[model samples]
Target: MRSQARQYAQSAQHRRAPPVRYSVAAAAVPIVAMVAAVYPVPMAVVVLAVVAVARYGRAAE
Candidate 1:
């Protein structure tokens, strides 16, 4: 019974964790761009925007 309970707990923990891809550029690039935009860095925003679009677009393909 305790072994079954441990298995269930492990499965639940895995499900609750965010998908690994979200930690990659798919999620990170946009956040960095937003912060750079607030700082009024035109170049950083442009570069970050291009990078994010390309990254997500490729993932969708």
Candidate 2:
């Protein structure tokens, strides 16, 4: 049918959006050191990680 052909054409014209991949290695390096410390893992460390994830997982403006 014409509608089917139109739908097929519309679908064919569509393309996927590009992937936006990045790494938080910069933030993670310090956190890893913090985690490896001999003392107890504190909430401040957890907060730092959350902040790091938010801060580093963005496209740098």
Local error of candidate 2 at 41, Å? 1.7
TM-score, candidate 2, is 0.31
Stretches of candidate 1 off by over 4 Å are 1-41
What's the lDDT for all of these models?
0.64, 0.56
Any idea what lDDT model 1 has? 0.64
Residues 29-60, candidate 1: write the lDDT tens digits.
Answer: 66776878688778865786767766766675
Question: Per-residue lDDT for 1-61 in model 2, tens only?
Answer: 7699567645754763222332334436565667757567786876786666656555442
